[model samples]
Target: MSGPGDVLDLIRERRAFTRGDVLEITGMSRMTVATRIDALLEAGLIIESGTEKVAAGRPSRRLEFNTGHAFVIAANVDTTHTTVALTDLAGRVAAEERIEVAVADGPDVTLNAIADRAKHLLADGRIGREDVAAIALSIPGPVDPDTDRPSQPPIMPGWDAYPIPDHLKAALDVPVLVSNDADAAALGEQRVAHPGSRALCFIKVSSGIGTGIVLGGKAYRGTDGGAGDIGHVKIAGHGDLLCQCGARGCLAAAASGRAVARALVDLGKPTASASDVGVYLADGDPDAARLTQAAGRVIGEVVATMVSLLNPSEVVLGGVLASPPLLAGVRETLYPRSLPRATRHLSISQSTLGEKATAVGLAAMVVEREYSASAVNAALARS
Candidate 1:
């Protein structure tokens, strides 16, 4: 055990523990445990919550991770809007807001709006800016792992290689972490909804399609941060279709929300974006349902390959068009095409968190990054 950081992790893992329990589990000297525990208490990372009776003479004071020690700013940026939330260290939302800032408006306008809204939320909640540990952002595109910036996003024009973290950090004056929206949503779902699922996949079918994979309770970003760009996966018999990435026969071109909306528009339903498609689906529009179902089947064809490869415990469909018809279509094609072994333990479902999934995931990312053992240790040393 290094010190308070490890102790904090132990307290957080157990929810409530005593100094004697830490000493017993770590096998550290009584004096050393006292020193570490005192340091954490001083830093406000851990707090005493009443006492627990022991077999011996005296009772032991119970300690727990102090969720109020700091807050996290979680922002999920999509094509049409951004959802900003202030979350506790425990990934619980304390306050949230929605802003109408389109990604197509470019980063400057959108990021500034997000920062302004976040500040408003903090003020409304009576939380100081200094109390914020970090900010986590989820964008509707792939983020470069090395630079922490958007990397050649197709629908997100003018965002390629943009210094997203740097821009947000400058505005917020705190550490900023950027991730793909799908990846964030996957992490959020796994942590909140499917806590037992060690391996899971989240497929986001919006204006574009993306996949987020969680293995061993962590988001699996690929070598270049393009692990789940399934929207661009080439589907047979769609060669005539073109994607926003200037590619032909891409899955998104044929079956994404944009594709469905386009088909709906051709049929004279007057839909333009994924949100519109979602409204129609909710209203039980037959044309919209039919198109969404067909799109789901096409997406399922691609997911079948993923199921075979990853053998995930759960596959969640998220994003704007995640509905009953879509889920049904996916089940129709995915199970029939996937191997029996893969399908035996697989459970496919719609997103439980709905629009809040990305924000929850971003909060998880913030907590994991800001409160990791090393980060906590560094803060303690500095203090």
Candidate 2:
């Protein structure tokens, strides 16, 4: 690891630290630590916040990271809406706005809208466009992380094999990272709500249902990037309803927000979209609650398998329809179906971060990518 990068990491983890603390923890020579500190300060990546009071001798100055040294753009795209935000290096959102655009509009139209909105948000924040260190995007589909491209996304048509990173990089003139929304939500929820969680699963039930897995504080996207894609899991008896993936009896077709909306329409409630269903739920519509509860039970059938397979410590329910019925349905089915050993310590609950989970997750991923030891070293050396 680069000395300056390690020093910066220590400061970030500890929030504030003295040169002596860095030297001791890093086991670096005094001269090495001093040189690293000087390099970081010269690069404007850190600030001398204040001195720590000492009982004896002279007080030592504590170093703190300069979170505003650069900014990152984070975008969270779902089936019916997109959110773009400007965040500091520490992933704290400085400005954010939501755009009501349908993902069915295709990648060209949607990604362009996101890029344009990000520019406007940066303008509103009065941050120079050139100061953007990176951009992170969270989409409602499985992403091939190796290539940062959507891969056979059932809900997101015209996005398959789309070079999202290259497209966004062309528009924003910075490197871009892309991930599935469920994966992003998992990371965001785990970091904020369950920081101590070693095995966590975030379930998103919107136009589609997906799961994000995290273990040991890091994402566990299986090889080829389709690990937690529980949406396509087939149900034994429900072969009547067709899924967006061109398959029958898929969990999404039976249990997603769209599924319940379709159910509501069957009962003459006639919701055009999941967002409309959310409105019905907000207004305490009993039919919506009942269908949602049934949807949850269907999803719970799939989640039971996941709990047994991964034995996650936490199962977070999120998305537009993460309401009472869904939460209750998941808990009701998950508790009884899952093995006793797996359910012993598992905590299933609705997401506390709600709609902001994707944005928070995207920002965190960007920060981690931009502030890795090698990335920091490379950045300072170029500077």
Candidate 2 lDDT score relative to the true structure: 0.85
Give model 2's clash tally: 0
TM-score of 1: 0.92
Model 1 Cα lDDT, one tens digit per residue, 1-383: 99689888888766438998998899999999999999999999889989899888689999988888988888889888888888887668878888999999999988999889877877765777789988888888998888889888878878999888888888878888999999999998998899888799999999899999999888998988998889998999999998888989999999999999999999988997988999999999999999999999999999999999999999999988999999999999999999999989999999989867776777777777788878899989998
Q: After superposition, how far is residue 47 of candidate 2 from its true place, in Å?
A: 4.2
Candidate 2, residue 382: lDDT: 82
Regions of model 2 farther than 4 Å from truth? 13-21, 47-64
Top TM-score prediction, candidate number: 1
lDDT of 2 by residue, 1-383 (tens): 45588778788666338887886787888889889999999988889977898667789987887878888788888787888888876567878888988889999999999999987877665677678878888888888878989888887888999999888889888889998889988998987899889999999888888999998878888887888999999997789989988989998888888888898999988799888888999999999999899889989988999999999999999987999888998888888898999999999899998966776677678767788777888878787
Number of the predicted model whose lDDT against the real structure is largest: 1
Model 2 vs. true fold: TM: 0.91
Clashes of 1: 0
